[model samples]
Target: MKCITRSLSCLILATVASVAVACSGADGADGAMGLPGADGEAGVKGDPGAAGENGDKGDPGTAAATEGTLTGTVTDAVLKDPLADVTVTVKDSGGATLGTPVKTGADGKFSVKAPVGTVVLKLTKTYYTDSADIMVGVIAGTTVSIAATMSEAATGAPTVTLAWTGDDFGYGKTATLTATASSPTGSTLTYAWANNTATKIGSVAAGTDPKTATATLPTLADATKLRTEGGVETQYVSAYKLPDRLEVLSIVPDTRGAVSVGVTVTDGRGQKATASASLNAASIQTGLRNVALGQRVYLNSGHDGTNAWTLTTKPAGSTATGRGGICSPPPRGGEYVRGGRESRRDSRGRSSAT
Candidate 1:
């Protein structure tokens, strides 16, 4: 019996050892990974940080004034009275209009703003002549004042028209200058004539009729030449060596030039209107010389016995002597006794043929 118990105990112990060995085996491969969990909720936000310090101050700015002012007055030229409601249109040098037009006040005063440059003012109004292209200058940030004038309209003034009788009139021809003038009130018009030339080539005379005048165009014998400072006729010599009694010197040439006839017609009211006409006067005769004062001239050798000639301011001096036959030598040299007739001194200090 004791031997059978011992065998059973050994078998039990062996089975237990086998069970422990299976339990202590090496680690097996890891199992598959599980799915991830969901995310958590966010927390409350914190307050914002404080602002940073300010930067340094900047530099000062510059002024801006790119315009100026213009003020002026408009007045009537004849009456010297202030003109109201005058339209002032400003323009640049290139005729470009600047800004809107300004009207004058009752005191003829006006003010306007303009750019920094030159500008022109064009003034206009009813019953008055239009005064245009008046120049003015403006400066930046400054005011410029000026005064302007305009003439009265010619509504009631006399109107005159002038014309010549013939276009064939020339140097040696007589020109009939006729002026047709009329006043609004039909007043008798008295005409005054003038020769508008540096040299007075002919005589200007008013006709017996009030509207008619005559200008005897210069002939070769009538035109006289004189020296001028700059071809201008401003010097006048004394006719009788008296103060303030001067006469114009002649300066007619032997070439092409124009002479104008101006006529002023005065109405009964003394309001005068003027009209002028230009006539071209040219000498056809060539080689003719002026024999007047300060002129060196010679007489033609082809003179007939019936010809009478008067010499003035001979080449010798300012005085002249009249001779019948031929020109004698000047008094500085002895006179030439011509025609074999005796020559004797007359009572008037003149040489005559005996």
Candidate 2:
């Protein structure tokens, strides 16, 4: 019995030892857990960059801007200074207004801006006479200056008188009529004279009071006849009468080849007298013939007997001959002798004896 008990105890001890050894082997084989993986390395920060430089400046821009002008002054006749407060206006060639009204300054100066064209500058002042038709030109980008003078206004009635100083009776002769006038206002005078009836000659400006005008008379186209009481056969060559002025004695031609011009002279008191005289034609014809021939000629009984006689050579096959009166024999030429008588008369009826 004692031996069995000892053997049971040894067996239990061996089993215990075996269990302890197995527990020891399991612990050694499995490694301890790595300390929770070291937290991921903190993320590295990005490097700071260098700063950039500024850019360059830009270029300049363009400008904007009108065309041109006309400047001038308005003054009076004396030109002492400019006329102030005068209304100055500019008009185109068609007389259309270009701009607004501009008044003259204290210095009598005014200006206007207009487009390119033909223009007229007009000036007006109170109670003063204005000028007519002052023309100018305005071009692009150009300026023009003009100076104007104004005249004084006129006042009352205009009186006019005319005087004629020329041969009123002659073929192709011109008669001149001059007129003088006196008044406070300006006047325009027109004069007319005729032979048988009234006819208009011409008109002219007599200007501001105390002025003169002139006109040349035209020639008459037809012949006139007259008779005198001295038993003389007189012919009227030409006649002229003033319709507006005065009545004069009748003029006549004398028996001699001369003009008997008559005039009725009135004294300061208005008393009138009749006067007549002979105007010799010899001197006038001699002067006219000398001018025509460019040389001197003989003046006999108021006739240019020297150069008036021209010997014309007849053309071949021509039958020209004297029709009436005395036919002197042809001298040294085969041409026929021709002769005719010429007669002239003044305003009076008279004839030259044959």
Candidate 3:
């Protein structure tokens, strides 16, 4: 029995040692779990660290855009009063209207903003005669001022009357021609003298006062030629100067069965008027006959004779008489004698031909 007891004790001791080794292996397995606990604390929070330095300055942002303006005024021409509600337009030199129309303010001021370039400005109104144009340069952030003056529209057609100081003129003589003109409203008077060549001398100031101009009677060389030679009547002496006076005989007949005539019968610087009848046909014929008798007739000789004349007898055997004469002298002596010899005999037979 003692031997059996001792064997049992030895078996127990071996069992215990084996158990202790197993327990050690179990603890080794639990060591990985202890590492998980340490990791938990480490994840709980990181240690606080030093602050970082400021980051490099960011790149500059894109630059902002810039901007501009145009400004101006409108006024009346004569009164210089501010004009409101006038349409102001901007344009280019090419005449194209640009942007929008701006109406003037109560103070007649206007302004506009545009890009940098050359621009044309125009101001217009219905009551104004016409529009006006202005040139300007548009720049960024700049205000351009364009001023304009408007003129009043014309109401009606202006009347113009012309009168001369003297109607009768001598060849190659210069006369101070005083032209008196009148108009209801002030008129811009223009002077013109009509001939074969129409010529405009000049224009005078706008007013009711008369305007004067001086023109010289052209020389014969300067006179307008009307006839084609062949002993034709080259020119008619419409104005004449007597020994002591000047006269303008009308080309038409008067109510007194005589030619209407105007005779300035006074001497130099004197005033005179006459209402007597002009030369009758018979008197004209008589005067023509006397002139044919070779009486010397003095005329303004300054003309180059472009308007001069000399009388010549009719060609022999020519049926031409008064109306048919190829070439005939001007009527003289203020008498009209018909039927050559018969009229002459009648004049000599009667004491008074009238």
Q: Whose lDDT is greatest here?
A: 1
C-alpha root-mean-square deviation, each candidate? 22.7, 22.2, 17.8
Q: For residue 76, what is the lDDT in candidate 3? A: 74
lDDT of 3 by residue, 56-136 (tens): 899999764343578877787766778888888878788888788898899989877655678777787664655756777
Record all residue pairs in model 2 with backbone atoms less than 3 Å apart, i.e. clashing. Answer: 234-349, 234-350, 235-350, 252-348, 253-348
> TM-score of every model?
0.30, 0.26, 0.28
RMSD of 2: 22.2
List ranges where model 2 is wrong by over 4 Å: 1-67, 155-354
User: Residue-pair clashes per candidate, as listed?
Assistant: 0, 5, 31
**Candidate 2 C-alpha lDDT tens digits along 1-354:** 999999999999999999887775434566777777667887889898888898898787754224358888887664345778888887878889877979999998988787676778788876467768678877677888888887645432234444555332332233333334443422233332222112222222222332222222222222222334267533233233212111222333331122333333332222233333332221122111212211111112222111123324533544332211111222232433222233434347565422
lDDT at residue 36 of model 3 (Cα atoms): 35
Question: In terms of TM-score, which candidate is strongest?
Answer: 1
Where is the poorest 10-residue window by lDDT in model 3?
Answer: 195-204
On TM-score, the stronger of 1 and 3 is: 1
When sorted by lDDT, best at the front, the candidate numbers are 1, 2, 3
